[model samples]
Target chain A: MICEEMQERISELMDAELDDNESIPVHRHLSECQTCRSFFTSCQKMREAVQSIPYEDKRADYYETKKEWWRNYVRVPLPAAAVFILLFITGLIGTSMYLLQSDDPYVSGEHRIIYISEYPEIEIHLLTDRE
Target chain B: MDPSIIQKLRNGNEEARTEFYKQYRQQIYVYCYQLLGNRSDAEDTAQETFIKIFNGINSLQTAAAFRSWVYKIARNESFQLIRKKRPVALSHKLEYLEKDSVENLIESEDNARIVRNAIDTLKPEFREVILLREYHHLSYKEIADVMKTTTSAVKTKIFRARKSLLKKLSPYFGGI
Candidate 1:
Protein backbone atom coordinates (compact mmCIF):
# COMPACT_ATOMS: atom_id res chain seq x y z
CA MET A 1 0.00 0.00 0.00
CA ILE A 2 1.23 3.45 -0.88
CA CYS A 3 2.10 5.60 2.08
CA GLU A 4 -0.32 8.46 2.65
CA GLU A 5 2.59 10.85 3.06
CA MET A 6 4.02 9.90 -0.33
CA GLN A 7 0.68 10.20 -2.12
CA GLU A 8 0.01 13.58 -0.59
CA ARG A 9 3.41 14.92 -1.51
CA ILE A 10 3.46 13.61 -5.12
CA SER A 11 1.20 16.28 -6.55
CA GLU A 12 2.86 18.90 -4.43
CA LEU A 13 6.24 17.86 -5.82
CA MET A 14 4.96 18.14 -9.38
CA ASP A 15 3.62 21.60 -8.56
CA ALA A 16 6.99 22.59 -7.00
CA GLU A 17 5.19 23.58 -3.85
CA LEU A 18 7.42 21.42 -1.67
CA ASP A 19 10.51 23.11 -0.27
CA ASP A 20 13.98 21.80 -1.08
CA ASN A 21 14.12 19.95 2.27
CA GLU A 22 10.71 18.41 1.63
CA SER A 23 11.54 17.54 -1.98
CA ILE A 24 14.26 15.04 -0.97
CA PRO A 25 11.77 12.61 0.53
CA VAL A 26 9.45 12.95 -2.53
CA HIS A 27 12.36 12.37 -4.90
CA ARG A 28 13.47 9.32 -2.96
CA HIS A 29 9.91 7.96 -2.93
CA LEU A 30 9.48 8.52 -6.69
CA SER A 31 12.80 6.80 -7.41
CA GLU A 32 11.65 3.75 -5.47
CA CYS A 33 7.96 3.73 -6.45
CA GLN A 34 7.03 3.34 -10.12
CA THR A 35 3.36 4.15 -9.57
CA CYS A 36 4.05 7.48 -7.90
CA ARG A 37 6.54 8.50 -10.56
CA SER A 38 3.98 7.88 -13.29
CA PHE A 39 1.46 9.89 -11.33
CA PHE A 40 3.88 12.78 -11.17
CA THR A 41 4.45 12.72 -14.96
CA SER A 42 0.72 12.78 -15.66
CA CYS A 43 0.18 15.60 -13.19
CA GLN A 44 2.79 17.66 -15.00
CA LYS A 45 1.13 16.95 -18.34
CA MET A 46 -2.28 17.94 -17.04
CA ARG A 47 -0.95 21.19 -15.68
CA GLU A 48 0.60 21.97 -19.07
CA ALA A 49 -2.56 21.10 -20.99
CA VAL A 50 -4.66 23.33 -18.78
CA GLN A 51 -2.17 26.17 -19.02
CA SER A 52 -2.27 25.95 -22.81
CA ILE A 53 -5.94 26.97 -22.95
CA PRO A 54 -4.90 30.29 -24.32
CA TYR A 55 -5.41 33.27 -22.07
CA GLU A 56 -5.89 34.40 -25.67
CA ASP A 57 -5.25 38.06 -25.15
CA LYS A 58 -8.69 38.16 -23.59
CA ARG A 59 -7.66 41.50 -22.18
CA ALA A 60 -8.04 43.27 -25.52
CA ASP A 61 -11.70 42.50 -25.80
CA TYR A 62 -12.24 42.88 -22.08
CA TYR A 63 -10.72 46.34 -22.13
CA GLU A 64 -12.68 47.33 -25.19
CA THR A 65 -15.92 46.18 -23.67
CA LYS A 66 -15.13 47.95 -20.40
CA LYS A 67 -14.39 51.15 -22.26
CA GLU A 68 -17.53 50.86 -24.36
CA TRP A 69 -19.71 50.16 -21.36
CA TRP A 70 -18.24 53.02 -19.33
CA ARG A 71 -18.73 55.40 -22.23
CA ASN A 72 -22.36 54.48 -22.48
CA TYR A 73 -23.41 53.99 -18.87
CA VAL A 74 -21.01 55.55 -16.35
CA ARG A 75 -19.52 58.47 -18.25
CA VAL A 76 -20.21 62.00 -17.03
CA PRO A 77 -20.83 65.03 -19.22
CA LEU A 78 -17.91 67.55 -19.01
CA PRO A 79 -19.35 70.27 -21.23
CA ALA A 80 -20.68 72.17 -18.26
CA ALA A 81 -17.25 72.24 -16.63
CA ALA A 82 -15.69 73.38 -19.91
CA VAL A 83 -18.25 76.16 -20.23
CA PHE A 84 -17.73 77.30 -16.66
CA ILE A 85 -13.99 77.41 -17.14
CA LEU A 86 -14.34 79.44 -20.34
CA LEU A 87 -16.62 81.97 -18.60
CA PHE A 88 -14.21 82.30 -15.67
CA ILE A 89 -11.24 82.94 -17.99
CA THR A 90 -13.17 85.53 -19.96
CA GLY A 91 -14.26 87.32 -16.80
CA LEU A 92 -10.68 87.35 -15.45
CA ILE A 93 -9.34 88.83 -18.71
CA GLY A 94 -12.11 91.50 -18.78
CA THR A 95 -11.48 92.44 -15.18
CA SER A 96 -7.71 92.65 -15.73
CA MET A 97 -8.17 94.94 -18.74
CA TYR A 98 -10.57 97.19 -16.80
CA LEU A 99 -8.10 97.43 -13.93
CA LEU A 100 -5.23 98.27 -16.31
CA GLN A 101 -7.20 101.10 -17.96
CA SER A 102 -8.78 102.57 -14.82
CA ASP A 103 -6.94 105.78 -13.63
CA ASP A 104 -5.20 105.08 -10.30
CA PRO A 105 -5.17 108.49 -8.67
CA TYR A 106 -2.40 107.52 -6.19
CA VAL A 107 0.18 106.98 -9.00
CA SER A 108 -0.98 109.68 -11.43
CA GLY A 109 -1.49 113.53 -11.77
CA GLU A 110 2.27 114.46 -12.21
CA HIS A 111 2.52 117.34 -14.67
CA ARG A 112 5.24 116.68 -17.29
CA ILE A 113 3.01 118.58 -19.67
CA ILE A 114 3.30 118.02 -23.41
CA TYR A 115 1.73 120.54 -25.83
CA ILE A 116 -1.98 119.98 -26.21
CA SER A 117 -3.52 120.10 -29.65
CA GLU A 118 -5.02 123.59 -30.55
CA TYR A 119 -8.02 123.80 -32.81
CA PRO A 120 -7.61 126.34 -35.75
CA GLU A 121 -9.37 129.73 -35.14
CA ILE A 122 -11.95 130.41 -37.87
CA GLU A 123 -11.53 134.14 -38.73
CA ILE A 124 -14.65 134.63 -40.88
CA HIS A 125 -14.45 137.61 -43.33
CA LEU A 126 -17.76 139.40 -43.48
CA LEU A 127 -19.16 140.08 -46.89
CA THR A 128 -17.04 143.02 -48.30
CA ASP A 129 -19.99 144.66 -49.94
CA ARG A 130 -21.79 144.97 -46.66
CA GLU A 131 -18.70 146.75 -45.14
CA MET B 1 -26.39 62.77 -20.14
CA ASP B 2 -27.19 59.16 -19.02
CA PRO B 3 -28.40 60.25 -15.59
CA SER B 4 -30.90 62.35 -17.59
CA ILE B 5 -31.34 59.23 -19.76
CA ILE B 6 -31.51 57.06 -16.67
CA GLN B 7 -34.16 59.33 -15.21
CA LYS B 8 -35.99 58.99 -18.45
CA LEU B 9 -35.50 55.23 -18.33
CA ARG B 10 -36.94 55.14 -14.81
CA ASN B 11 -39.91 56.93 -16.32
CA GLY B 12 -39.76 54.36 -19.13
CA ASN B 13 -36.75 55.51 -21.13
CA GLU B 14 -36.69 52.98 -23.91
CA GLU B 15 -33.82 54.87 -25.53
CA ALA B 16 -31.63 54.73 -22.45
CA ARG B 17 -32.39 51.07 -21.98
CA THR B 18 -31.42 50.47 -25.57
CA GLU B 19 -28.16 52.27 -24.92
CA PHE B 20 -27.52 50.02 -21.95
CA TYR B 21 -28.05 46.96 -24.12
CA LYS B 22 -25.77 48.31 -26.82
CA GLN B 23 -23.05 48.84 -24.23
CA TYR B 24 -23.07 45.58 -22.22
CA ARG B 25 -24.39 43.11 -24.77
CA GLN B 26 -21.03 41.91 -26.06
CA GLN B 27 -19.37 41.56 -22.64
CA ILE B 28 -22.33 39.61 -21.33
CA TYR B 29 -22.27 37.43 -24.43
CA VAL B 30 -18.56 36.65 -24.06
CA TYR B 31 -18.76 35.98 -20.32
CA CYS B 32 -21.66 33.61 -20.92
CA TYR B 33 -19.70 31.83 -23.62
CA GLN B 34 -16.79 31.32 -21.24
CA LEU B 35 -19.05 29.85 -18.59
CA LEU B 36 -21.38 27.73 -20.73
CA GLY B 37 -18.77 26.25 -23.11
CA ASN B 38 -20.89 26.82 -26.22
CA ARG B 39 -22.40 29.64 -28.23
CA SER B 40 -26.13 28.91 -28.21
CA ASP B 41 -26.64 28.42 -24.47
CA ALA B 42 -24.29 31.31 -23.84
CA GLU B 43 -26.43 33.63 -25.95
CA ASP B 44 -29.55 32.79 -23.97
CA THR B 45 -27.81 33.00 -20.61
CA ALA B 46 -26.17 36.27 -21.59
CA GLN B 47 -29.55 37.86 -22.26
CA GLU B 48 -30.93 36.55 -19.00
CA THR B 49 -27.87 37.68 -17.03
CA PHE B 50 -28.19 41.21 -18.32
CA ILE B 51 -31.86 41.40 -17.46
CA LYS B 52 -31.08 40.35 -13.90
CA ILE B 53 -28.20 42.81 -13.62
CA PHE B 54 -30.45 45.62 -14.80
CA ASN B 55 -33.43 44.82 -12.61
CA GLY B 56 -31.32 44.10 -9.57
CA ILE B 57 -28.56 46.75 -9.55
CA ASN B 58 -30.58 48.79 -7.07
CA SER B 59 -30.37 45.98 -4.57
CA LEU B 60 -26.61 45.66 -4.93
CA GLN B 61 -24.70 46.72 -1.84
CA THR B 62 -21.45 47.58 -3.59
CA ALA B 63 -20.90 48.86 -7.10
CA ALA B 64 -17.21 47.96 -7.05
CA ALA B 65 -18.06 44.30 -6.70
CA PHE B 66 -20.35 44.28 -9.70
CA ARG B 67 -18.16 42.09 -11.91
CA SER B 68 -18.04 39.28 -9.40
CA TRP B 69 -21.75 39.73 -8.72
CA VAL B 70 -22.55 39.50 -12.40
CA TYR B 71 -20.29 36.48 -12.73
CA LYS B 72 -22.13 34.85 -9.86
CA ILE B 73 -25.38 35.35 -11.74
CA ALA B 74 -23.98 33.85 -14.93
CA ARG B 75 -22.46 30.95 -13.01
CA ASN B 76 -25.85 30.19 -11.50
CA GLU B 77 -27.50 30.30 -14.92
CA SER B 78 -24.93 27.91 -16.35
CA PHE B 79 -25.39 25.50 -13.43
CA GLN B 80 -29.12 25.56 -14.02
CA LEU B 81 -28.52 24.61 -17.65
CA ILE B 82 -26.22 21.76 -16.57
CA ARG B 83 -28.87 20.51 -14.16
CA LYS B 84 -31.54 20.52 -16.83
CA LYS B 85 -29.32 18.77 -19.37
CA ARG B 86 -28.22 16.08 -16.91
CA PRO B 87 -25.71 14.67 -19.35
CA VAL B 88 -25.60 10.98 -20.22
CA ALA B 89 -23.52 8.55 -18.20
CA LEU B 90 -19.99 7.87 -19.37
CA SER B 91 -19.07 4.51 -20.93
CA HIS B 92 -16.07 3.19 -19.00
CA LYS B 93 -15.90 -0.36 -20.27
CA LEU B 94 -12.33 -1.24 -21.32
CA GLU B 95 -13.20 -2.62 -24.73
CA TYR B 96 -10.18 -1.17 -26.54
CA LEU B 97 -7.28 -3.12 -24.91
CA GLU B 98 -9.07 -6.37 -25.89
CA LYS B 99 -8.52 -5.85 -29.59
CA ASP B 100 -5.17 -7.01 -31.10
CA SER B 101 -4.79 -3.50 -32.39
CA VAL B 102 -1.43 -2.65 -30.74
CA GLU B 103 -3.29 0.36 -29.31
CA ASN B 104 -1.90 0.43 -25.77
CA LEU B 105 1.49 1.82 -26.65
CA ILE B 106 2.73 4.82 -24.65
CA GLU B 107 2.61 8.23 -26.47
CA SER B 108 0.08 6.93 -29.00
CA GLU B 109 -2.64 9.26 -30.31
CA ASP B 110 -5.25 7.05 -28.71
CA ASN B 111 -3.61 7.55 -25.31
CA ALA B 112 -3.73 11.31 -25.64
CA ARG B 113 -7.34 11.21 -26.77
CA ILE B 114 -8.26 9.01 -23.85
CA VAL B 115 -6.56 11.36 -21.41
CA ARG B 116 -8.35 14.34 -22.92
CA ASN B 117 -11.64 12.52 -22.77
CA ALA B 118 -11.00 11.53 -19.20
CA ILE B 119 -10.41 15.13 -18.27
CA ASP B 120 -13.65 16.09 -19.97
CA THR B 121 -15.48 13.38 -18.05
CA LEU B 122 -14.33 14.47 -14.62
CA LYS B 123 -17.07 15.49 -12.19
CA PRO B 124 -17.83 19.20 -12.43
CA GLU B 125 -16.65 19.92 -8.90
CA PHE B 126 -13.21 18.53 -9.58
CA ARG B 127 -13.13 20.02 -13.05
CA GLU B 128 -13.99 23.47 -11.79
CA VAL B 129 -11.30 23.40 -9.12
CA ILE B 130 -8.71 22.41 -11.70
CA LEU B 131 -9.91 25.00 -14.17
CA LEU B 132 -9.97 27.79 -11.64
CA ARG B 133 -6.54 26.86 -10.36
CA GLU B 134 -4.76 26.21 -13.65
CA TYR B 135 -6.71 28.11 -16.30
CA HIS B 136 -7.87 31.05 -14.23
CA HIS B 137 -4.66 31.17 -12.17
CA LEU B 138 -6.63 31.97 -9.06
CA SER B 139 -4.89 31.73 -5.72
CA TYR B 140 -6.40 29.60 -2.99
CA LYS B 141 -8.00 32.57 -1.28
CA GLU B 142 -9.44 33.96 -4.50
CA ILE B 143 -10.84 30.59 -5.45
CA ALA B 144 -12.36 30.28 -2.01
CA ASP B 145 -14.00 33.61 -2.60
CA VAL B 146 -15.40 32.47 -5.91
CA MET B 147 -16.42 29.06 -4.66
CA LYS B 148 -17.62 30.43 -1.33
CA THR B 149 -15.38 28.26 0.74
CA THR B 150 -12.41 28.77 3.01
CA THR B 151 -8.85 28.99 1.65
CA SER B 152 -7.72 25.72 3.30
CA ALA B 153 -10.73 23.98 1.83
CA VAL B 154 -9.91 25.28 -1.63
CA LYS B 155 -6.33 24.14 -1.31
CA THR B 156 -7.37 20.67 -0.22
CA LYS B 157 -9.88 20.46 -3.05
CA ILE B 158 -7.28 21.47 -5.62
CA PHE B 159 -4.79 18.99 -4.27
CA ARG B 160 -7.36 16.21 -4.35
CA ALA B 161 -8.60 17.11 -7.81
CA ARG B 162 -5.09 17.08 -9.24
CA LYS B 163 -4.45 13.70 -7.65
CA SER B 164 -7.62 12.29 -9.13
CA LEU B 165 -6.84 13.67 -12.59
CA LEU B 166 -3.33 12.25 -12.49
CA LYS B 167 -4.72 8.85 -11.51
CA LYS B 168 -7.10 8.93 -14.45
CA LEU B 169 -4.37 9.91 -16.91
CA SER B 170 -1.67 7.57 -15.61
CA PRO B 171 -2.76 4.36 -17.35
CA TYR B 172 -2.67 5.99 -20.75
CA PHE B 173 0.75 7.53 -20.18
CA GLY B 174 2.15 4.12 -19.15
CA GLY B 175 2.43 4.13 -15.36
CA ILE B 176 6.03 3.61 -14.52
Candidate 2:
Protein backbone atom coordinates (compact mmCIF):
# COMPACT_ATOMS: atom_id res chain seq x y z
CA MET A 1 0.00 0.00 0.00
CA ILE A 2 1.03 3.59 -0.61
CA CYS A 3 2.18 5.79 2.31
CA GLU A 4 -0.98 7.92 2.16
CA GLU A 5 -3.21 4.88 2.57
CA MET A 6 -1.00 3.48 5.28
CA GLN A 7 -0.99 6.83 7.09
CA GLU A 8 -4.76 6.81 7.14
CA ARG A 9 -4.69 3.37 8.71
CA ILE A 10 -2.02 4.23 11.27
CA SER A 11 -4.37 5.10 14.12
CA GLU A 12 -6.34 1.89 13.65
CA LEU A 13 -3.07 0.00 13.67
CA MET A 14 -2.02 1.64 16.92
CA ASP A 15 -5.43 1.06 18.47
CA ALA A 16 -5.68 -2.49 17.12
CA GLU A 17 -8.98 -1.50 15.57
CA LEU A 18 -8.00 -3.01 12.23
CA ASP A 19 -8.47 -6.70 11.70
CA ASP A 20 -5.38 -8.69 10.80
CA ASN A 21 -6.14 -8.86 7.08
CA GLU A 22 -6.78 -5.13 6.96
CA SER A 23 -3.69 -4.26 8.99
CA ILE A 24 -1.23 -6.38 7.06
CA PRO A 25 -0.66 -3.91 4.25
CA VAL A 26 -0.44 -0.97 6.67
CA HIS A 27 2.03 -2.86 8.84
CA ARG A 28 4.06 -3.81 5.80
CA HIS A 29 4.12 -0.19 4.65
CA LEU A 30 5.21 1.01 8.09
CA SER A 31 8.08 -1.49 8.14
CA GLU A 32 9.29 -0.37 4.71
CA CYS A 33 8.65 3.40 4.95
CA GLN A 34 10.91 5.15 7.44
CA THR A 35 8.82 8.34 7.42
CA CYS A 36 5.55 6.58 8.22
CA ARG A 37 7.29 4.48 10.82
CA SER A 38 8.73 7.55 12.53
CA PHE A 39 5.35 9.26 12.39
CA PHE A 40 3.72 6.28 14.06
CA THR A 41 6.46 6.13 16.67
CA SER A 42 6.04 9.84 17.42
CA CYS A 43 2.32 9.40 17.79
CA GLN A 44 2.87 6.66 20.33
CA LYS A 45 5.43 8.71 22.24
CA MET A 46 3.18 11.78 22.22
CA ARG A 47 0.33 9.74 23.62
CA GLU A 48 2.56 8.45 26.37
CA ALA A 49 3.99 11.86 27.19
CA VAL A 50 0.54 13.42 27.32
CA GLN A 51 -0.85 10.65 29.44
CA SER A 52 2.04 10.79 31.87
CA ILE A 53 1.20 14.19 33.27
CA PRO A 54 0.18 13.79 36.90
CA TYR A 55 -3.27 15.17 37.51
CA GLU A 56 -4.13 16.13 41.05
CA ASP A 57 -6.72 13.86 42.60
CA LYS A 58 -7.71 16.15 45.45
CA ARG A 59 -11.37 16.78 44.73
CA ALA A 60 -12.87 15.97 48.09
CA ASP A 61 -13.18 19.63 49.02
CA TYR A 62 -14.95 20.49 45.81
CA TYR A 63 -17.29 17.55 46.19
CA GLU A 64 -18.12 18.49 49.75
CA THR A 65 -18.79 22.09 48.79
CA LYS A 66 -21.01 21.10 45.88
CA LYS A 67 -22.90 18.57 47.95
CA GLU A 68 -23.54 21.17 50.62
CA TRP A 69 -24.77 23.61 48.02
CA TRP A 70 -27.19 21.11 46.56
CA ARG A 71 -28.42 20.19 50.03
CA ASN A 72 -29.07 23.78 51.06
CA TYR A 73 -30.73 24.49 47.75
CA VAL A 74 -33.06 21.52 48.04
CA ARG A 75 -33.58 21.33 51.77
CA VAL A 76 -34.76 24.85 52.53
CA PRO A 77 -37.64 25.07 50.10
CA LEU A 78 -39.08 21.58 50.60
CA PRO A 79 -40.73 22.03 54.01
CA ALA A 80 -41.94 25.47 53.03
CA ALA A 81 -43.50 23.98 49.94
CA ALA A 82 -45.14 21.25 52.02
CA VAL A 83 -46.57 23.81 54.41
CA PHE A 84 -47.85 25.93 51.54
CA ILE A 85 -49.55 22.92 50.00
CA LEU A 86 -51.06 21.95 53.34
CA LEU A 87 -52.39 25.44 53.91
CA PHE A 88 -53.85 25.59 50.42
CA ILE A 89 -55.64 22.26 50.84
CA THR A 90 -56.97 23.26 54.25
CA GLY A 91 -58.26 26.55 52.88
CA LEU A 92 -59.92 24.73 50.00
CA ILE A 93 -61.63 22.30 52.34
CA GLY A 94 -62.81 25.09 54.67
CA THR A 95 -64.24 27.11 51.81
CA SER A 96 -65.98 24.05 50.41
CA MET A 97 -67.51 23.17 53.79
CA TYR A 98 -68.69 26.74 54.31
CA LEU A 99 -70.27 26.79 50.88
CA LEU A 100 -71.89 23.37 51.31
CA GLN A 101 -73.53 24.24 54.65
CA SER A 102 -74.58 27.84 53.75
CA ASP A 103 -78.17 28.74 53.05
CA ASP A 104 -77.53 30.34 49.63
CA PRO A 105 -79.83 29.28 46.81
CA TYR A 106 -77.14 27.00 45.40
CA VAL A 107 -76.43 25.31 48.76
CA SER A 108 -79.74 23.31 49.07
CA GLY A 109 -80.46 23.75 52.78
CA GLU A 110 -83.16 25.03 55.19
CA HIS A 111 -83.03 28.84 55.40
CA ARG A 112 -84.44 31.84 57.34
CA ILE A 113 -84.86 35.14 55.52
CA ILE A 114 -82.16 37.63 56.69
CA TYR A 115 -82.67 40.61 54.34
CA ILE A 116 -85.24 41.78 51.78
CA SER A 117 -84.41 44.32 49.02
CA GLU A 118 -87.07 46.77 47.85
CA TYR A 119 -86.34 47.74 44.22
CA PRO A 120 -85.37 44.35 42.85
CA GLU A 121 -87.47 42.63 45.53
CA ILE A 122 -84.69 40.10 46.31
CA GLU A 123 -84.56 38.14 49.61
CA ILE A 124 -81.38 36.96 51.38
CA HIS A 125 -81.62 33.90 53.62
CA LEU A 126 -79.29 32.47 56.24
CA LEU A 127 -79.14 28.80 57.30
CA THR A 128 -80.28 28.57 60.93
CA ASP A 129 -79.62 24.77 61.10
CA ARG A 130 -76.04 25.18 59.97
CA GLU A 131 -74.80 26.08 63.50
CA MET B 1 -22.54 1.77 37.36
CA ASP B 2 -23.59 0.00 40.47
CA PRO B 3 -27.28 -0.82 40.41
CA SER B 4 -27.72 -0.25 44.12
CA ILE B 5 -25.99 3.13 43.97
CA ILE B 6 -28.10 4.04 40.98
CA GLN B 7 -31.25 3.01 42.76
CA LYS B 8 -30.29 5.04 45.79
CA LEU B 9 -29.45 8.05 43.66
CA ARG B 10 -32.79 7.69 41.93
CA ASN B 11 -34.39 7.50 45.33
CA GLY B 12 -32.75 10.85 46.25
CA ASN B 13 -30.19 9.41 48.55
CA GLU B 14 -27.54 12.04 49.43
CA GLU B 15 -24.92 9.57 50.55
CA ALA B 16 -25.33 7.64 47.35
CA ARG B 17 -24.88 10.79 45.32
CA THR B 18 -21.69 11.59 47.19
CA GLU B 19 -20.44 8.09 46.64
CA PHE B 20 -21.19 8.37 42.96
CA TYR B 21 -19.24 11.62 42.74
CA LYS B 22 -16.29 10.08 44.53
CA GLN B 23 -16.33 7.10 42.23
CA TYR B 24 -16.27 8.97 38.93
CA ARG B 25 -14.78 12.38 39.69
CA GLN B 26 -11.15 11.44 38.98
CA GLN B 27 -11.85 9.86 35.65
CA ILE B 28 -14.09 12.72 34.65
CA TYR B 29 -11.46 15.21 35.73
CA VAL B 30 -8.81 13.45 33.68
CA TYR B 31 -11.10 13.44 30.68
CA CYS B 32 -11.76 17.12 31.11
CA TYR B 33 -8.12 17.93 31.72
CA GLN B 34 -7.04 16.16 28.57
CA LEU B 35 -9.77 17.83 26.55
CA LEU B 36 -9.34 21.36 27.90
CA GLY B 37 -5.56 21.21 28.61
CA ASN B 38 -5.91 23.34 31.69
CA ARG B 39 -6.28 22.36 35.32
CA SER B 40 -8.71 25.10 36.38
CA ASP B 41 -10.91 24.67 33.34
CA ALA B 42 -10.96 20.94 33.86
CA GLU B 43 -11.94 21.35 37.51
CA ASP B 44 -14.72 23.77 36.69
CA THR B 45 -15.93 21.57 33.88
CA ALA B 46 -15.83 18.50 36.07
CA GLN B 47 -17.84 20.31 38.76
CA GLU B 48 -20.45 21.37 36.27
CA THR B 49 -20.48 17.88 34.78
CA PHE B 50 -21.31 16.26 38.10
CA ILE B 51 -24.01 18.78 38.87
CA LYS B 52 -25.62 18.13 35.49
CA ILE B 53 -25.32 14.40 36.04
CA PHE B 54 -26.91 14.56 39.46
CA ASN B 55 -29.73 16.81 38.29
CA GLY B 56 -30.41 14.72 35.20
CA ILE B 57 -29.56 11.24 36.45
CA ASN B 58 -33.23 10.36 36.73
CA SER B 59 -33.66 10.74 33.00
CA LEU B 60 -30.89 8.21 32.33
CA GLN B 61 -32.65 5.09 31.06
CA THR B 62 -30.19 2.56 32.42
CA ALA B 63 -27.27 2.46 34.85
CA ALA B 64 -25.05 0.81 32.28
CA ALA B 65 -24.95 3.96 30.16
CA PHE B 66 -23.78 6.16 33.03
CA ARG B 67 -20.11 6.41 31.99
CA SER B 68 -20.85 7.49 28.45
CA TRP B 69 -23.59 9.84 29.58
CA VAL B 70 -21.34 11.54 32.09
CA TYR B 71 -18.59 11.82 29.48
CA LYS B 72 -21.00 13.47 27.09
CA ILE B 73 -21.83 16.05 29.73
CA ALA B 74 -18.16 16.71 30.40
CA ARG B 75 -17.46 17.17 26.71
CA ASN B 76 -20.31 19.63 26.39
CA GLU B 77 -19.30 21.58 29.47
CA SER B 78 -15.68 21.77 28.33
CA PHE B 79 -16.71 23.02 24.94
CA GLN B 80 -18.94 25.65 26.46
CA LEU B 81 -16.06 27.06 28.46
CA ILE B 82 -13.75 26.87 25.48
CA ARG B 83 -16.19 28.84 23.38
CA LYS B 84 -16.43 31.51 26.02
CA LYS B 85 -12.67 31.99 26.08
CA ARG B 86 -12.29 31.89 22.31
CA PRO B 87 -8.53 31.49 22.55
CA VAL B 88 -7.08 32.75 19.26
CA ALA B 89 -3.59 31.68 20.23
CA LEU B 90 -4.28 27.97 19.87
CA SER B 91 -5.12 28.07 16.18
CA HIS B 92 -2.28 30.44 15.42
CA LYS B 93 0.15 28.16 17.25
CA LEU B 94 -1.08 25.15 15.33
CA GLU B 95 -0.44 26.99 12.08
CA TYR B 96 3.06 27.91 13.21
CA LEU B 97 3.84 24.36 14.40
CA GLU B 98 2.85 22.88 11.04
CA LYS B 99 6.29 24.10 9.86
CA ASP B 100 8.22 22.67 12.81
CA SER B 101 9.61 19.18 13.65
CA VAL B 102 7.41 17.88 16.50
CA GLU B 103 8.54 14.26 16.36
CA ASN B 104 12.13 14.97 17.40
CA LEU B 105 10.98 16.56 20.65
CA ILE B 106 12.38 15.05 23.85
CA GLU B 107 10.29 13.84 26.80
CA SER B 108 10.85 16.34 29.55
CA GLU B 109 8.44 18.41 31.59
CA ASP B 110 8.95 21.12 29.01
CA ASN B 111 8.25 18.68 26.18
CA ALA B 112 5.14 17.50 27.99
CA ARG B 113 3.97 21.08 28.09
CA ILE B 114 4.69 21.35 24.38
CA VAL B 115 2.67 18.20 23.73
CA ARG B 116 -0.17 19.61 25.76
CA ASN B 117 0.07 22.86 23.84
CA ALA B 118 -0.06 20.89 20.62
CA ILE B 119 -3.15 19.07 21.83
CA ASP B 120 -4.77 22.30 22.98
CA THR B 121 -4.27 23.70 19.50
CA LEU B 122 -6.54 21.07 17.96
CA LYS B 123 -10.10 21.94 17.09
CA PRO B 124 -12.59 20.75 19.67
CA GLU B 125 -13.77 17.89 17.49
CA PHE B 126 -10.33 16.42 16.84
CA ARG B 127 -9.12 17.19 20.35
CA GLU B 128 -12.01 15.35 21.98
CA VAL B 129 -11.53 12.27 19.80
CA ILE B 130 -7.83 12.13 20.59
CA LEU B 131 -8.37 12.64 24.32
CA LEU B 132 -11.14 10.05 24.55
CA ARG B 133 -9.25 7.44 22.60
CA GLU B 134 -5.68 8.03 23.76
CA TYR B 135 -5.95 9.34 27.30
CA HIS B 136 -9.22 7.92 28.50
CA HIS B 137 -8.81 4.62 26.60
CA LEU B 138 -12.50 4.57 25.70
CA SER B 139 -13.61 2.00 23.17
CA TYR B 140 -14.66 3.13 19.73
CA LYS B 141 -18.25 2.17 20.46
CA GLU B 142 -18.18 3.97 23.79
CA ILE B 143 -16.70 7.07 22.15
CA ALA B 144 -19.40 6.87 19.48
CA ASP B 145 -21.99 6.80 22.22
CA VAL B 146 -20.45 9.84 23.94
CA MET B 147 -20.12 11.71 20.64
CA LYS B 148 -23.52 10.56 19.37
CA THR B 149 -21.92 9.26 16.23
CA THR B 150 -21.36 5.87 14.64
CA THR B 151 -18.44 3.66 15.56
CA SER B 152 -17.10 3.98 12.02
CA ALA B 153 -17.20 7.73 12.37
CA VAL B 154 -15.36 7.52 15.67
CA LYS B 155 -12.65 5.37 14.17
CA THR B 156 -12.23 7.68 11.20
CA LYS B 157 -12.12 10.76 13.38
CA ILE B 158 -9.57 9.18 15.69
CA PHE B 159 -7.44 8.26 12.73
CA ARG B 160 -7.60 11.74 11.32
CA ALA B 161 -6.95 13.24 14.74
CA ARG B 162 -3.89 11.10 15.29
CA LYS B 163 -2.61 11.98 11.82
CA SER B 164 -3.03 15.65 12.55
CA LEU B 165 -1.25 15.22 15.86
CA LEU B 166 1.54 13.39 14.15
CA LYS B 167 1.98 16.19 11.65
CA LYS B 168 1.94 18.81 14.39
CA LEU B 169 4.49 16.93 16.47
CA SER B 170 6.69 15.79 13.58
CA PRO B 171 8.68 19.05 13.46
CA TYR B 172 9.80 18.65 17.04
CA PHE B 173 10.99 15.12 16.33
CA GLY B 174 13.74 16.58 14.08
CA GLY B 175 14.47 15.35 10.48
CA ILE B 176 11.88 12.54 10.76
Best by DockQ: 2
Local distance difference test values of all predictions, in order: 0.59, 0.75
Computed on C-alpha atoms, the DockQ of candidate 2 is 0.29
Looking at candidate 1, what is the lDDT of residue B129?
A: 71
Please provide, for model 1 over B1-176, each residue's C-alpha lDDT reduced to its tens digit, 9 standing for 90 to 100: 24454444344344665666666566556545545555667767765666665555555555444444655676777767756765521121123323222334344655445554454556667777777667655555556666777867776777788777766665544443
Candidate 1 pairs with clashing backbones: B9-B13
Candidate 2 RMSD to the real structure: 6.0
Which predicted model would earn the best lDDT?
2
lDDT of model number 1: 0.59
Which digits, one per residue and each the tens of the lDDT, describe model 1 over residues A1-131? Answer: 56555866776565455789999988898899877776677767778766654323233344444433323443233455579889999999998877766565322332233343572454433322211
Over B37-74, each residue of candidate 2 has an lDDT whose tens digit, in order, gives 66777888887887777767778898878778889999
DockQ of each: 0.10, 0.29
Error of 1 at B131 (Å): 1.2
Q: What is the lDDT of residue A14 in candidate 1?
A: 56
Looking at model 1, residue A28 earns an lDDT score of 91
